[model samples]
Target: MFLVGLTGGIATGKSTVSCMVKDMGVPVVDADLIARQIVEPGRRAWKKIREVFGDEVFLDSGEIDRPKLGAIVFSDIEKRRALNKITHPDIYSEIRGQVFKHFLRGEQFVVLDLPLLYESNRVSSYLYKTIVVSCDDELQLERLLERNQFTEKEAIARIEAQMPLDRKCQLADIIIENSGSIAETRKQVEGIIKLLRSSNHHIYNRVFYGGIFIVVLTAIAMLMYWIFMR
Candidate 1:
């Protein structure tokens, strides 16, 4: 399957575009959802977090106190990297598993909805293309403040923590300008879906990988036969 990486700055409407793609019948492996899941109460990441950050970051019910953790990491770059180190491996593992499941089901393309697709670059090598959803910086700050109820300072800190939207757009194969109306964003998404569907890259990938598999099997068989003959 052709893997497309979808990313954007915080509050840049990346989620909106991701939903549009999903609603249009494309498979999306959501990294944010996977990140939440991997850090649940007793998961490996949860235990590591508990060990590293101590009991303060957890609630009485044993769930990670996400807001508390977010406050820490967003304010401190070291803390954020420490958190990423703990959770990223598990997140990527789950993402890969989901992508493989979709590929096995013969999906032509799958979108990986990642917030830090460029920052981490962990899965960039596997992507057939990348789409970055972006908007004006001021609008992004306003949306984040309203949606997250964070003070302007807190919101700006979180935004500054990420790679800039302009840089992301520069690296993107396709850029969806989300500074306009929802209708405009939807139109762009539709065009992107049409472009992806028309590419038919998945067929070529499958054939290429299948040929390699066959070649390996044939080589192993020939080696076994020669040993037996000897």
Candidate 2:
């Protein structure tokens, strides 16, 4: 599978580009979704966090108080690393599983949507290109304020928590400037996908022939218990 790493700073329209890519029927493995799944009330991560940080981090509904926890973690690098130490492995495991599933399905291309792609060191080596959606700091601040109802300072805090956009863009294989309209951004995504479909022969071969082995193994794993139990 051709696996592209997608990333951008907070509120820089990464979500918009990801959605558009999905809307156009490309398979996307969203790290954010996986992160959320791993942190739900009864999940191992949640239980561990509760044990470590105690009850004050939970709400009346017995769920982790994300905002409260975020406040503490974001302000301190050690705490931030501690939180990531708890969550990143689980999320990465989930991501690997999903990508393998997509590969087994004979998919020619897939996107790994990770917000902290560069910050997390996920972009250093990849099977496919890395794409960074970016906007200027001022525009990012404005868009974040409008989208999340965050004050300018609040948005800046979140943005500051990430590496600078310019640095991220410099690392990207493809820099998608998302400061423009939806049409412009979508056009860029569309053009990139179209070129990739025509240009990537290795991916075409993997999907056409090698993927059958993957699919058969996945099927065996999924159905083995049913067959053996009977």
Candidate 3:
């Protein structure tokens, strides 16, 4: 199986590209969606967040008020780190399980759509390719403000919190310039999908085997340590 990572800045049309990919019959495991799911009221992440952030972050219905939580975490670096520390492990575990399921099923390809893929450094040791969707900076700010109704300060803070778009563009294996019409963006996505379908999967196979070897070796090392110490 081939795994591809899709990422972009907030409100940068990453979801749009992801949707286009899904429409092509490819499986997409969206990190954002998984994040939301893992934080549902009764979930461990939600419980921990409420314990840390307290009742202020929750609504009357007991759901986590995302805007309230965002306002808190986005403005405070330490708080953001704390939040990530609590949630990232579970989110990554779920994503890994989903990807492995597809891999074991012999899927031709799968997409992991993550907004913070670069920030989290989720590229290497997995993923055959990465695509960063981007638009004009001014346009991105406008879209964010309109979509979230955030003040300029709030919007800018959120955007700045992640790795800069230019840096991600430099690092990405492919760039989907989404500064134009939806049709244009869709066309670009189609072209990329076509290429991926035709591309060789040897690199992906090597990564999988390498990962398995590492896991097996680690288990053997642990067993040896236990035997010697005991």
Candidate 4:
């Protein structure tokens, strides 16, 4: 099975595309979901975060106050890096496991929904293809404001914190322009799905592994024949 990496800037409709893919019965290993799971109340990542950021970032219910933590990290590069350092390893480990499960299930391809696919840059090398979902900056800003209820300054800061959408598009094997209507976006996603389904990566991998298995079996038979002759 081959792996596809799906990414986009904040509020660029990556999640929307991800949901579309999921609805189509494609396996998607979502890193954002894994990140949240890893940091749940008493998880190792949660413990590390509480240790580093202190009790202030936790709510009265002992859950991490995401907004409070986000406010802290988004403004400070070092703190952001520290947070990533604490959580990333766990997140990646879980993502890898999920991908492996899909592979064992003999999926044709799996999509990894990673918000930081470009920024992290670690998993891209393993992906058969990378897709970037993007919109115009104005539309992106407008969406962020509406969805997150953030002031213009806060929305812009959040947008500026990640790798630029243009740079991500430049790196992508496919670009889904989400600035248009939902139907237009769905059409783009369907086209991408068809393209990925038609790919020869999975076929090539099966052929390659089958050849290796045959070679190993032949070598074993030859060794057994030699032993019998002796």
Q: lDDT of candidate 1 vs native?
A: 0.95
Ranking by TM-score: 1, 4, 3, 2
lDDT (Cα, 0-100) at 121 in candidate 1: 94
**What digit string (tens of lDDT, one per residue) describes model 2 on residues 87-187?**
99899999889988987797878899998888888545864688999987889898888987876777778889998999999988898988888899999
lDDT of 2 at 85: 88
Evaluated with TM-score, which candidate comes out highest?
1
Ranking 1 against 2 by TM-score, winner: 1
Deviating ranges (above 4 Å) for candidate 1? 226-230
Q: How would you encode candidate 3's per-residue C-alpha lDDT over 1-230 as one tens digit per residue?
A: 77899999898999999999999998999999999989998999999999899999999999999999999999999999999988999899999999889877778889999888888885554778999999999999999999999999999999999999999999899999999999999999999999999977956575878799899999999999999999
Worst 10 residues of 4 by lDDT: 204-213
Tell me how far candidate 4 lies from the true structure as C-alpha RMSD in angstroms: 3.1
RMSD per candidate (Å) reads 1.2, 5.6, 4.1, 3.1
- lDDT score, residue 195, model 3? 94
Clashing pairs in 3: none
TM-score on alpha carbons, each prediction: 0.96, 0.86, 0.89, 0.91
lDDT of 4 by residue, 160-221 (tens): 99999999999999999999999999999999999889888998887887799899999999
Task: Report the CA-based lDDT of candidate 4 relative to the real structure.
Answer: 0.94
Clashing pairs in 1: none
How many Å off is the CA of 50 in candidate 3? 1.1
Lowest summed-lDDT stretch of 10 residues in model 2? 200-209
